[model samples]
Target: MIVIYGIKQQLTPIKAELSDVIHQCMQEVLGFPEDKRAHRFIPMEKEDFYYPGGRSEAYTVIEINMMAGRKVETQKKLIYTLFERIEEKIGILPIDIEITIKEQQSYQWGFRGMTGDEVNDLKYKVNV
Candidate 1:
């Protein structure tokens, strides 16, 4: 699963479009197959966010966290695709985006009270 959180000053006509653009980039990067991609958007006010040494003028930061299933080639492709989309949609010539990937075993994550075993078994049973 891939999770995305977009933080920008209160949503405006333009900023709102940015949120959608970011989400689309994420979905494409993860190869969501037109479905099964989950994401969340967290918007903040300009005054409420502090970038430290980062600038706020038409700048954005994108962070991605996911398991190691995706190949390095796929990861690079996703990042490039995201930057291309951002440039096209937001018109921000110089934007900053960062992504991080990690490897996680299936047992480490669970849904409801079931672990990976139960979920995989259920899917296998259904397919059979």
Candidate 2:
């Protein structure tokens, strides 16, 4: 799953493009399927969305959650791919975007009404 946060005016209009870019990056770097897209956009007010200096209102934060086991190189590739694709395809500068990947043990995840470890049928491998 991916969670995106940005100011409403700058973020709402590009939700579709952002989701496409994110899923595309995931497919390329993470080997995810085209149909496996889970994205959440949180559009906040200007006053609510505080950002760091030197960045415009375009500043966005993306948080990706997944099961652990991917190599460091793979994770780095995902980040770089997202930055490049988002900037080129969504018109969001890499400098104005922040991305973080949060990984947890498979056993800790619950899906399909079962714990990750108990749910054995998965379309993709987690240990990439």
Compute each candidate's TM-score over C-alphas: 0.63, 0.97
Lowest summed lDDT across 10 adjacent residues in model 2 is found at: 119-128
lDDT of 2 by residue, 1-128 (tens): 89999999999999998898899888888889887898999999999999999999999999999999999999999999989999898888989999999999988998779988887777777888
State model 1's lDDT: 0.54
Runs of candidate 1 with Cα error greater than 4 angstroms are 1-7, 10-29, 52-54, 116-118, 121-128
Estimate the TM-score for candidate 2.
0.97
Q: Which candidate has the top score in TM-score? A: 2
Poorest lDDT segment (10 consecutive residues) of candidate 1: 119-128
Q: Which stretches in model 2 have alpha-carbon errors above 4 Å? A: none
Instruction: Encode model 1's per-residue lDDT on 73-119: one tens digit a residue.
Output: 77777778777876787765444444454556556667668765445
Report lDDT (CA) for all predictions: 0.54, 0.91
